[model samples]
Target: MIRRSILFCLMIVFAVSLCACHKENPDPSGQNPDSSPTPTTPDTVTIAPVISGGGINLVAKLIYTVDASTAKVVRSTVMVRDDTDITPALVIDCIVESLKDESLNLSFDGIEYSDGVCVVDFDDSIFTIAGKSADLEDAILDCIAQSVLDNVDGCMKIIYRIHNEAYSTVNRHFAYDFVYMDD
Candidate 1:
């Protein structure tokens, strides 16, 4: 009787220990071990815009000066993604990202688009450029406008802002009264 009682007590202890070690499963279905849904990856696309030699192309014309007086325009296309639902802000982002070599030191604070208009808020970094000539600034602005016009479908105009205020002066050379992409 004592041996049987000892065996019963040992079995009860073992059962209790197993129950204590058991963890509550977040997913009652028991299909997902981690109780988290599977993650999906988005598709990516690569585009190569033709680099213009000296003449003009149909994509975008970026005008700048080599010396102090000689002005030049270089035409090129912007890289596009394969995904749908492309917004005007995304196009502006692509244009900003494409200027890797120009050293324009341009950065946007925020971009909002609605009703065929895109309002870009830029930081004061653009105005702080050391040697930003009038022609170069004009070319940069034109490039941004032309790039948006060529890429975005519904966007008809672009407004520049510095710190949420009107971007009236870049080195006090650009009046920057909103640019119409359609024009």
Candidate 2:
């Protein structure tokens, strides 16, 4: 009985102290006393693909969120199977897959990067699905080029291959060529 009484008293004291700790310790500026960290949303987000890369490396590809000033890289965690072929098309496909978000609205069939040239191959039917708007084309190309320039080393230019022919960036609204060095 005595032991139980002491335990009950201790618990009461603990509760009282805890309650006192939460008393109004307000700043002079008169903000809320119960201050907490504010939640902020990220700009770039990468989604996990349904066909996962079942391999050792967690981050198998990278995407990019671009603006006039800088390009922010968003990495993707794709684990490829051990015996899978790491082809040029596969690498660029992984890159494009990781970059599907609200900012850029489109998809591609295949991609290749070599000797400072990035080739994005898409079926001509993409226009039928997404419409024939010049703005969409510019945004899609800009997003693709930004992702390639940020992730692929020596990727100085991008070629949009629609009719099996390499096509360069004709509009030139954004600065896509980034592979330059002073050696």
Candidate 3:
């Protein structure tokens, strides 16, 4: 009877130990019975910059109106960020040099920012150039496009004009759709 009692006690102790072990081991599926806040992943957080309303510059006087029969002339001014490290002026000068002797002239009227787009307008003389070769014409457009791409990160598009007329077509080199190639 003593031996049988000892065996029963040992069995009970073993069963108790097994139950304790099961309690210590957590569920593999991670569905814990305890209700607590789970730690969040760090990658889910996003931070953005704060923009003020008065930061934009406008140049309303530089704009000129075009006649209804003629192509529309749109003038936009873009501000070069005072903090930007890039040299946009140098790029513009390079483009001007590339149009050497082509009678193409580009002027930096001023810098202005409106809405989210930066507008950089050139004088009407930029389009008044004459006697340009096919290659020179392409280079002129490329120069302007590249300048904007290289200098301005905020600018997604550029509008080209000659004497305030929409630069829709070129005479000898390409079609009016030449500006679309920048895409």
Candidate 4:
């Protein structure tokens, strides 16, 4: 008689469960009404770089040497602190700044890289202008050539000009066409 009572209760519970499961469970497509919308990403982001390493090695040529009989363009290494920037302009500017001083008679108007060559605009008319001696011009050109070859990268050769125009006879012998041969 006790077994019969237990079996009757189990059958009643099963019937109640079947009725509890509704046929339309919120249409299966739309949200549950309590949920929120999905998020989207932003359009653009601008951030500065946190650079590492000590930075690049540069060579600053000695522009002023009284003993111009020998090579005056003595190059030495300089370590640039590139904490946040490494653009070509920045690097070139740094090189020019490193080259600056009263004794060093060299100055750069500007420097830019395009296509394949790096154009270096020099501000030193002291050598390229009216009636400077050819030897002086040659020495200056040599210094400029060596400096560019030692410091800059990516370009096969460097092109130097004063005020954007090529130097007359100097470009023939001691040209800015210093080609980089890989070691």
lDDT of each: 0.60, 0.51, 0.45, 0.50
TM per candidate: 0.53, 0.41, 0.35, 0.42
Ranking by lDDT: 1, 2, 4, 3
Candidate 3 local distance difference test against the native: 0.45
- Superior by lDDT: candidate 1 or candidate 3: 1
Error of 1 at 72 (Å): 4.3
In model 3, what are the clashing residue pairs, if there are any? 77-119, 78-112, 78-119, 168-176, 169-176
Q: Write the per-residue lDDT of candidate 1 for residues 11-65, one digit (tens) a residue.
A: 9999999999999977878787745876653233333446755432233322221
Question: What RMSD does each model have against the real structure?
Answer: 17.8, 13.9, 20.1, 23.7
Name the 10 consecutive residues with the lowest summed lDDT in model 2: 174-183
Q: What TM-score would you give candidate 2 relative to the actual structure?
A: 0.41
Give candidate 3's total backbone clashes.
5
Report the Cα lDDT for candidate 2.
Answer: 0.51
lDDT of model 1 at position 27: 83
Name the Cα RMSD for model 3.
20.1
lDDT of 4 at 50: 56
Residue 74 displacement in candidate 1 (angstroms): 2.6
**Per-residue lDDT tens digits of candidate 2, residues 1-183?**
999999999999999999988857457776776877786533333455468773242334445432322233334444444445544455556544554443433456666667767666666544542354455455455555665565555656666665454433333222233322211
Q: Model 4 clash tally? A: 0
Candidate 1 to truth, TM? 0.53
Query: Pick by lDDT: which candidate is best?
Result: 1
Find the 10 residues in a row with the least total lDDT in model 4.
58-67
The residue pairs found clashing in candidate 2 are 53-79, 53-80, 54-79, 54-80, 55-79
Per-residue CA lDDT of model 3 for 22-129, tens digit only, reads: 655477776777878887644223333358444433211111221212222223223333444443444455445534423345565643334423334446553443
User: Each model's number of backbone clashes?
Assistant: 0, 5, 5, 0
